[model samples]
Target: MFDEMLHWPFFDERHRALRALGDWADSALDDLVAQEHAGGDVYALTPQFVARLGEAGWLRLAASLDGRLDARSICLARDMLARRSGLGEFAFAMQGLGSAAITLFGTPDQRERYLRGVMDGTRIAAFALSEEGAGSNPGEMEMAARRDGDAYVLNGEKTWISNADLAHQYVVFARTGEADGARGLSAFVVEADAPGLSVIERIPVIAPHPLGTLRFDECRVPASAMIGAPGDGFRIAMSVLDVFRSSVGASAVGLARRALDEALKRAAARRIGGRALADYQMTQDKIADMATAIEASALLVYRAAWVKDTTGARTSREAAMAKLFATEQAQGVIDRAVQLFGGLGVTVGMPVESLYREIRALRIYEGTTEVQKLIIASGLLAAASHGN
Candidate 1:
């Protein structure tokens, strides 16, 4: 059903070819998912998953000729990955997210040094921006990067970071003190094993992921490692988010679509008072809602991707709308799926149950639903105030 979406004007022949991502993910990802749920280490599996994606040539899509990412390709790839395995999706998304800074703003030397490893899956990359004081409001982050001759000395703590302990390198943002709040921040590529850096603690979340806190005690990187000019971290981070936010929505759609498919299958199989659950008007209603939400989410996600790919304009409003609507609605859709499955829904190993956990985080990350609302409203007000 999702493959049919490629026919929309939002996509082209190149985009349609990406449907092959789903075929590969569906077949290759299940055994690995089972292994993880059975207590295999998630962090341990990331490299393998990434390596597989790289070997299969999927990771190559994370890059581009003009150094500009294709938003539509990204969204489609994520949709397929999330549908098959949340952890698989995480591995793929982080590659794009982690390297996005370098791809967008780094010097040629930076790109040459870092990007090939990412595309080949020999090294893992992470984006470290969130801090204890700056999850929603990044401007309040306290980490500082002090210029020290030929290098910058970093000292602070970053929490709730993805790929924390496992990533080979991180693109870290810290205050360079050019100004207060977000304006003062700068981005640098820091190796995971840098002398003064350590993975402080691994965080356990509702889903299986490599999340942790990182501490930088006088951690240093060469001055040449800075992604962009001083005080450009905030802009660079926002630009990266603008590129990936719509892909986040596409991931949610994938999760919700999987949930909907599971519910539909269960409805056809489960007997209720001598009739299959699908025969009930109540069950039909739930299925209707789930399908509608999936359709709507896919529409918003692809529309945002289309706008980004076509206009070369900033997609703040479109991406926020897509992320907000798709994530919020997918939550409801998955809950309905769980409801349809009864006890099996809550069972830890079940597909719908796993999806239930996976979908919850989508609402919170990649700019929360509240943040998206603020972004959308702020854009409208800004445009209206100028009479645009």
Candidate 2:
């Protein structure tokens, strides 16, 4: 619907190519969904879905040759996939997030050992940073990793982990130093089959995928498994989030666009009061608001991505703003679509009903809307203080 934005200054030929590839991948989404449904196991279906993306070479966009992430490309990929299928977007996002620490901070040997398998979809990856008590505050984490003679022994639990039981390796963060809060945390690559590592329980969310809690009981990994320095875990996590957060906004924008499209089609075709719903001034107003919100969201999302791509500095403020606005607004747009559809909206097997469920978790995960506001406000206050 908003094809003009594709030609905007923020994007280039490569992004267009990526979008084309996404369109090609989307052509198979129905079959993919059918296969996943038939299998009736989200965890098992994930690898097959990822393998197809890898075969199609779309997963390569998750990481670049120089080991740096391209925010614009990631945003475009998520935007396109989310529009077609939420599961497709999830698969693409986890592949990048699961190994983001290694891509950004791992040694050459670490990258050589993990990145290749991840890119080819031979090995699944997961990021384990959040604990039961530390979903939003990493500083409150209790997971411990003690140094041994030549390895680190880890003991603790990570909850709400995506690809938990299915991942071959995890980028696990745990308290390692004597310092309290974030400084005590360290990041390590812990294999799923590690002696003391096991899935504690599977977590079922409204929109289901492979999610679960992991427990570590004296899990030991080689000293070389550490991503950076002992106290670098928090920084690594934030850096990775800085890159992916804008893409979350992009995905929101995609979802909003799809909602708008559905609303428009319904308004034009559905008859009401002896005329199509589009004839009503109130319906027109709703459509206008949805379109405006979607466009503004797109601008903010891609602008954040563009800034990150052109400048190496972390776009924390921009990313936060984008994610906060896009996700919040997308929820409103989808709700409006549901409203426009009336009883049909909530009916089982309806597209809008499915979308209504899918759009919800975006606001909670990665970072909640409340957390994004705090990040933005803190950044502004810091800037003002510097000016004074």
Candidate 3:
């Protein structure tokens, strides 16, 4: 089912990545899967996975040296990876998200210093944009950075950051003015060991990953560490997200596909009343709906990626639609898979049980489903007014 979707014009060339990457993942990421099923220490496992992915050259797909990203490739990579393991997709996605600002809008010196480390997986990276009050609304950010001589002294905290304590470097956004809201924000690169910066609290989500809050009390970073110019943080962050948001949808497609596959296999094998579960009309109805939703989501995912890669346009409307539908629907697909498995589905260590936990966070992060609706409607209103 997934292979057929690759024939879409969006991925004529990049679709080739699926086969090789999928084969590599099944073999190389087996240990990661076993660890996740056993509820292993995700923090300890993160670096090991990064090193392995880097050594295998998989991380290179996430870093764009020329500052031109191929969204289809990114979507394909995320789709294949998420189907296998949630943590695997998280590791790969962070390499791109953490350094995307630098890759797209950094000085030559900045790129030379940081891009390669992430591509090679030696530098685990984090994107610190969400503060306690700014999870969905970044404009409400209270984290501040005051200019001190040639350095910027940062203060306040960023919470719910992925790859938190495990990251070697962070792409941080903070307020730089008195009260201009998001317009006063600036983006900067700060190493983990930077003075006066520390992980204040580790946050455990429904799924396993390194998430936490970081506090900066007079943390001084060189002025050169800034990505783009002052007042460019909001633009830079939005630009980066515009490209990666569709990739999030692709990840949802992968998760949904995996759920569908699990459901189909179980229906074929599990029997009741002296017949296979797949023989029942109720089971067949579910299989049909899950397949339809997966295909619809996959089309939206690739369409958004294609528009970004080919047209170089801001995919606010398209990406939001893709994200809103894919994540929300994938949750439903995975839930049905769990119901199909009955008592065994809720049991820990079962594949559907793990997936149930994994699918919940995707809806909440990046941009929430509610946030996506606003974006889509805003785009529609703007387009209508412009007569486009």
Candidate 4:
């Protein structure tokens, strides 16, 4: 798979090893699909998928060999899994995202409790940041975390939370006080079994990833559950997003490549007007454009991953650029692939159609394309004015 494209320059031997692991995923995807079909239980299937990944030691690729959460590893894992199956990628991505706060800022005790589960896939992880009223505006979150004796009582509703009903724990965000917008907020690690916490509703999307609303009604936890410090949730969330957003882009690249591969195979075999579809210049142009876009998106996505891994930089701007460009370009490539496939593209269960739906959410999640643009422009302007 790595040799099939020109976007590999950003990767190293470690990344190649991870890419090779995709062979196991490709071989086993049929079994996974069959099981999901027989059971129709995303919650159960997802955990098993994670466990399988962990048992193969592929879940360890979500972090680093030394146990640090390396950004490049996360990117490569997402890319490979996404190429094989969207659910596979979603399952891998959430483990890292749900546990990122702990990996980055947790105390030794916190890491031992959370990171172990994440690495071993014994526990599923989740990030609960988006509220109905505060989807894009963090300052608008109404969920309040009030101090009560030695514990913090969390009261808020978080909707569209990934792995909502399935996750064993969540890194939840809530406002501690109203000192300032986006400043009074704090992050906490809350157990799924925590009192007053419940899965209010399950939201189904075109893809089969798990999502739902979580209600924290006087949900209380020890102060030790707080990540970083009170009034620091906004910073922590942004820092975590910076690391994972690029991987979202990389996933998009993988999906786009799968679409392109399907298109190429179909075009080479299908005969139209007494000739193969490949004989037509129009078909050739579409293939060329799709291939170019795929490579370009992959480069941008992995470049961001590489920058974050090597320099340990904040990478907000680079990640935003990657997510923004790669997602947009990937959508275009998928659209072209569907066009190339003609009638077969829109057919249900076809790889291109599946990818079309799968790629749409990546643009919205992790930070929307518009949000990424604003981030990039704001950073550019700030850098220009500061001359640093």
Candidate 5:
């Protein structure tokens, strides 16, 4: 179903190769959910899964030497992975999200030390930004890093962190200056074994992964551990999000595509009044709506990714638009698929039911639907104010 979309002018030879690679990578993940659950601890299984992705060299696409991320490739990889396994998508995305700051802003030494391990699958990476009081508004983060001689002592907590205890290193954001709001923040590379760092709690959400709360009690890291200069944390965080946000939309598109496929199969096989479900006008209408939304979402997602790859400009507005439409529409599309499946849709262990759980968090994470709307509105207002 997604093959035709790859032929669109928005994609190129490299994008096609990435899609092919993703397909190959995903073929082995058929039992990822079961494998994860087999250990009786889904979070504990994340490191092994990430290692597999790294060993396959699929993680190389997530990082680049020139400090430029290929949004199109990332979107393709995420879309393909999401279609097959949510855990696969999560592992791939965390690799990118966790290491994006280092790729974009790390010093040569930092890159050499971390990037190699991250790409090789020997080491896991994570991004630590949200706090107890800060989610949508990261500017209110209370995690503070106080400079002490040759090191910075980190003292606070980060919650809802993916790959929390499993990551080898974390791109930790903390307040470093007296300036109010986000201006005071800075980014740091905190090793997992750092003296004061500990996983205080594990959090289980609708979709399971390695999520937990991290406590930094006077966790001292060398000043050399900082990703960029002081007060650059907010900038780095946004920059990373700007690159990855559209890919989140692409993932949603993939999940929706899978849902639609399942619905079509169900509709074709299930009979109503001695006729196929697909023969019914209402069923046709639902299928039409699902296909239309998926196509529109693909366009928006790929357009945003293309702009970022070609123009090298901040894609705040475009990314927001793509993420907003794709995630919201995916929920609707999946819901329709559930309806089509009737009782089986709501039943445990069904593909559509699993998708229902997986797609819900995409809207809440990365950035919420409400946050995307605000971003789009703010962009429009700013453009109007500038008379552009």
Candidate 6:
């Protein structure tokens, strides 16, 4: 189904093989989703699924063979699993996002101890950056860490954290001083069983995953848990997001593709005005729009992915553009699919409806549409001011 993407030549033979592996997953994923349904607990089910993905060597692709984050592999895995199942994509992505700090900046000892397990899926990873009061404004976070002896005592609450209950370890960001704003923030690695760490509550969404609030009351972690230097948390957080945000767009493309596929099947089979719905020019127009949206979105997503792979540049602007366009366009495409489906589109258990719910969160998480716009505009204005 993704074969059309080969036209761009953004990928190599190994990437094609990954796509084939993803195609193999299409049949098997129903069983995984069914198993998830039987358990009825995403928290419990996610670790097992992640472990299975690791043992199958798919999770290994989250990082390079030597254990650094692999941009292309991360993008490919997300796009594939997203096409199969939204939850599956979430499970795969958190591993890469959660481990990215260690991959990029961890000490040798840290990588030896943590990243290997993350790559093998023996350890589940979570990125705890968002707080109840600090959604888009990272500077507003109240979570603070103060040093005592060789440990940092973390105190405050982190909300809207994905994999909160299930993560074996979390890369948490907190203010390291009384200084105001983002400058005071630092990142630390906290174990699931660390002192004074607790899950306060689970937050449910339209398309649910493992999510909850994490409270840290004097939660102490060794100083060695800090990634890079203190006062570098903001850069680290932005770097991780810059890399993965494009993949979020890729996932949107996947969801849009599924929505388009379902709509196409319905349009071809359903009769309207004494002929198939596909026979209508209006239906053809909608299909054309959806197809065009997918194609254009794919171009943006892969271009960002490729640029990162080849240039090793900080991709803040490129990633912002990809996420901004693909996600918003996906919303439009899916809406058209639903319109084409009519009442059947809104029906529960329908693929397009699920895609609708799944696609909504992609726009909100990673970065909101509004946030992406700000990033893009700021970059453009900065470049203009520099006469570049």
Each model's lDDT: 0.91, 0.88, 0.89, 0.86, 0.90, 0.85
- Order of all candidates by lDDT, from best down to worst? 1, 5, 3, 2, 4, 6
- Predicted candidate 3 versus true structure: per-residue lDDT over 1-388, tens digit per residue: 8677777777776566556888899999998878877898999888877887788888877886778777888888899989998888889998988988988998888887998989888999899999878998889988888888899999999999999999999999999874487788899999999999999899988788999999999999999999999889988989889878888998898898899989999999999999999999999999999999999998998899889888987888888899889998899999999999999999988888988998898888888999999999988898899998
Q: What's each prediction's TM-score? A: 0.98, 0.97, 0.98, 0.95, 0.97, 0.96
Which of the two, 1 or 2, has more TM-score?
Answer: 1
Off by over 4 Å in 6: 35-39, 64-67, 178-180
**Tens-digit per-residue lDDT, 1-388, candidate 5:** 5889989999888788776665576566555657753433666566767787888888898875567678999999899888877887888899899999999999989988988898888888999999889989999999999999999999999999999989999999999985889999999999999999999998988777779999999899999999999999999999999989999999999999999999999999999899999999999999999999999999999999999989988899999999999999999999999999999999877889989999999998888999999999999999999998
Candidate 2 vs. truth: CA RMSD?
1.5
Worst 10 residues of 2 by lDDT: 33-42
- If candidate 6 were superposed on the true structure by all CA atoms, what would the RMSD be? 1.7
Q: Cα deviation of 165 in candidate 2 (Å)?
A: 0.9
Model 4 over residues 1-388: C-alpha lDDT tens digits? 4565424666667666665667888776668856653435787789988888877777776643243667777887787788887887888999889888887877788888777777787889999999998998899999999999999999979999999999999999999984789999999999999999999999988777899999998899999999998898999998899889999998998888788889889999999889999999999999898888877887788788888888987999999999999999999999999998888889877788888889999889988999998999999999999997
Across 314-344, the per-residue lDDT of candidate 6 in tens digits comes to 8999999999999999999999999999998
Q: Supply the global lDDT for candidate 2.
A: 0.88
Better of 3 and 6 by TM-score: 3
Q: What is the lDDT of candidate 1?
A: 0.91
True-vs-predicted CA distance for residue 108, candidate 3, Å: 1.7
Clashing pairs for predicted structure model 2, backbone only: none
Model 6 poorest ten-residue lDDT run? 63-72
Candidate 1 per-residue C-alpha lDDT over 1-388 given as tens digits, one digit per residue, 9 for 90 to 100: 7867888899889899988888887777778877866767998898888998888889877764347899999999999888888898999999999989999898888888888889888889999999988999989999999999999999999998899999989999999999988999999999988999999899999887999999999898999989899999999999899889999999999899889889999999999899999999999999999999999999999999899889988899999999999999999999999999999999988998899999999999888999999999999999999999
TM-score of 3: 0.98
Candidate 3 clashing pairs, residues 3+ apart or interchain: none
The true-versus-predicted C-alpha distance at residue 134 of model 4, in Å, is 0.9
Provide backbone clash counts, one per model.
Answer: 0, 0, 0, 0, 0, 0
lDDT of 3 at 283: 94
- TM-score of candidate 2 to 2 decimals: 0.97
